[model samples]
Target: MRLAAKANLGEGTISDFENGYRMPNPRKLAAMRRAFEGAGVVFATRGPTLTQPRWR
Candidate 1:
């Protein structure tokens, strides 16, 4: 998701998170959610049900 300008973070920092080079702090995670929301996007996590498991 594209972060908001007011997120006050540099592009490289975000890139690192996306590339798995870094994990964002809780505050930054909240900011990212807000940023996506501002852009009319929503982020979600989904997992399979207990009755259905898939191999990775």
Candidate 2:
């Protein structure tokens, strides 16, 4: 819920994406990525990595 709020997307949109039913538009996807980054996630070439302890 927090991630969805931070990404400015409805929970349904994120749930759909997680279930592999749909993808958010590029703008929404970018917002999601930014939200993840703000939460201390690091996107790496190999895969996403956590750079620090989670805040929430």
Candidate 3:
């Protein structure tokens, strides 16, 4: 999938993350953020909570 290609991660790894079988490290999280942001996703923070990114 695009996420896997963009993150330089295997499909299994992506699947694992999605399935909550594993958690991504800081580096992988950054890669994911970059990939999503490149696709026009913008993350927002409200107080101590994290909200979903706004799509443009």
Candidate 4:
């Protein structure tokens, strides 16, 4: 269920996204952006350094 209930998308839609069977429409993407923005989520871009940490 969408938090604002304005998206009106079902769980099946989310499932399709996770399964790579469907993609988010531009409207949905805008709604998500609005939601995240209202929630104070900051998106940033950071480049990796010459020496990156290894997971292993």
Candidate 5:
């Protein structure tokens, strides 16, 4: 699915955002994060021992 569709955003929104021509609000940001997570992406900070703790 397209990023916009996966994020439940309007068509072209993702493209615009990727092009730095648009910015998503907090809700949209969360939605985008969820979409990425659904695709098996895990967002986290790298630890000193190469371990990445979970996000929230």
Candidate 6:
């Protein structure tokens, strides 16, 4: 997926993180977070949810 490409990681690696099969290092996690934020994703601390930002 685009996230994998942007994170310079393999699709399988992203899948592993999503499926709870593995955990990424702090640096990788930060990279992924930045990528997602750039794509308009806003992370919420309530239950640690992912949501699109509301632009008004």
Candidate No. with top TM-score = 2
Candidates in descending lDDT order: 2, 6, 3, 5, 1, 4
lDDT tens digits, residues 1-56, model 5? 67687788987777778889989788988999887776667677862232342333
Q: Which should have the higher TM-score, number 1 or number 6?
A: 6
Over the stretch 2-56, how does candidate 1's per-residue lDDT look in tens digits?
Answer: 3535466778778899899999899987887666555555454673223332212
Q: What is the lDDT of residue 24 in candidate 6?
A: 92
lDDT agreement of model 4 with the native: 0.56
Q: Cα lDDT for residue 37, model 5?
A: 76
Q: Would you list the clashing residue pairs of candidate 4? A: none
Tens digit of lDDT per residue, candidate 6, span 1-56? 47898777778888999999999999889988887776667777763444664333
Which ranges of candidate 6 are over 4 A from the true structure?
47-56
lDDT of 2 by residue, 1-56 (tens): 38899888899999999999997899999999999998889998999998995666
The parts of candidate 5 lying over 4 Å away from their true place are 47-56
| Prediction 5 global C-alpha lDDT | 0.73
Instruction: Indicate whether candidate 3 or candidate 6 has the larger TM-score.
Output: 3
Give one digit per residue, the lDDT tens place, for model 3 in 1-56.
47888778788888999999999898988888777776666676742222454443
Error at 38, model 3, angstroms = 0.6
lDDT, residue 10, model 2: 93
How does each model score on TM-score?
0.62, 0.89, 0.72, 0.48, 0.71, 0.68
Deviation from native of the Cα of residue 56 in model 3, angstroms: 14
TM-score of 5: 0.71
Q: After superposition, how far is residue 56 of candidate 2 from its true place, in Å?
A: 2.4
| Candidate 3 residue runs with Cα over 4 Å from true position | 46-56
Q: What is the C-alpha lDDT of each candidate?
A: 0.64, 0.89, 0.74, 0.56, 0.73, 0.77
Candidate topping lDDT: 2
The C-alpha local distance difference test score for the whole of candidate 2 amounts to 0.89
- Each prediction's total of clashing residue pairs, residues at least 3 apart in sequence or on different chains, is 0, 0, 0, 0, 0, 0
